[model samples]
Target: MALALPRFAVFQSTVRQKNYLRYIHEDGEQHGFPQFSGEEIVSPYSKFEIERAKSTTAEGNDNGFVHIRCCYNNKYWVANSISSDSFIIAGADEPNEDQSQWSCTLFEPIPVDGEVGSSTTTTTKTTVHVRFRHVKLGHYLRSLVTRDNYHACVSTSYDRRYSR
Candidate 1:
């Protein structure tokens, strides 16, 4: 279902709010998605197109994330380059790494407009962002849009980056 979709989307963590999965756009150069926080907004590279694992890793044992390639760099995969911080989402001649895979799961669908909350107040849900997890890393994807690093990036798992 996810592989069939194509858009510039980010995965909001099911466990944490205001977190997303993203990569660095260092002046159009390849970079890694290692350290991220709530300092970013959104970038044109944030959007991506998802597809199957694009490999023959076995049939039923394939309980993992899909392959997400940046729409900007159709040749690059959301994987690490040579350096963990410099080259994150780079072009892969043959992609077969764990960092290149992402499992997107929509854990929650926002409530309807007429829905009432625990406080008895009407709720209005607008957007519907998906939840994507890094298969091997076990960290959720997030958009860490920031100004300090023009090549901003997304954190690994939770806001407390080093923690799990």
Candidate 2:
């Protein structure tokens, strides 16, 4: 049996005005969503207000997952698309279960993608190797901001020659 997810009895919103989720329009005209995609979208603490995420799908109805909308507007919060992170409020002309719909799930952010496969058979824990120093070990990985022809090992000792 599948494990059940958390649910909120009431979806509430505290806002003075309508919450508009702004996203930088990348390659297309500034307008309605889904057909056009934006570079990035963010629901900042100041601009947008989302105190709680509601699991509409868990209600056993056709809610199909969505952010609890602003109490005043009664619009559904939607992620623009999976491919693009741009976000917009669901319009009444469109269906509630459209691509704008989103579901909440428990997640642990990992360093890199593709390190973990999607299959349920096997699981893997991986970390991405970037130009950063390890705390315990004095060694450095990846070359970053260095003029040396070869990679130099950085020890615990501070050196003006090689900036840490």
Candidate 3:
């Protein structure tokens, strides 16, 4: 089942080196692809707004598929093509269900030893980890290590590295 996602959210990488998804303006103007930001704190550049798709596919209707729009630029996320290893970028001025819609799912976050609270013996989880599955490409959204940074892309396999 799909988890109830917030209208606006900050997608963070689930890898060991955790970071939030952000877009850096190219040429200090327009057009920028999604990348993982090194900052640990949430910022306007990292926050995105979720918009419901106008129509749903038979396979994604029950999965709560939706379009992810960047709050910084007001552009929607678009899968490059109907193929594997395509880059997901925030460039679409409008939402197209076939190219912009993504099937979202929730995953249980891996717990780290030092991450647990010490004040209380027991603690309750409040946040939900999410992953975006490309409708046309049939791959999960993942980040690729580019030089010293990571860029957003799609992969065929299921892995925690794809969780945001």
Q: Which candidate number maximizes lDDT?
A: 3
Residue pairs of candidate 2 with colliding backbone atoms: none
Predictions ranked by TM-score, top down? Answer: 3, 1, 2
How close is every model to the real structure, measured as TM-score? 0.42, 0.21, 0.67
Instruction: Please write out the lDDT profile of model 2 over residues 24-86, one tens digit for every residue.
Output: 223333232221111223322112222222323333222133232323233333433332222
lDDT per residue for candidate 3 within 69-140, as digits (tens), equals: 888898877755445665677777876654443422211222232243233447654555555676665566
Local distance difference test values of all predictions, in order: 0.41, 0.26, 0.57
lDDT of 3: 0.57
Spell out the clash pairs found in candidate 3. Answer: none
Model 1 Cα lDDT, one tens digit per residue, 1-164: 11222334454434445544444555433253323332343654455555555434323323334565655555444434222222234355343544344422211112223232233337643344444444445445444455655323543425454333
How many pairs of residues collide in model 3?
0
Q: What is the alpha-carbon lDDT of model 1 when measured against the actual structure?
A: 0.41
List RMSD in Å for every model shown: 9.2, 19.0, 7.0
Better of 1 and 2 by TM-score: 1
- Candidate 1 wrong stretches, greater than 4 Å: 1-47, 54-64, 79-88, 97-128, 145-147, 150-152, 157-164
In TM-score terms, candidate 3 sits at: 0.67
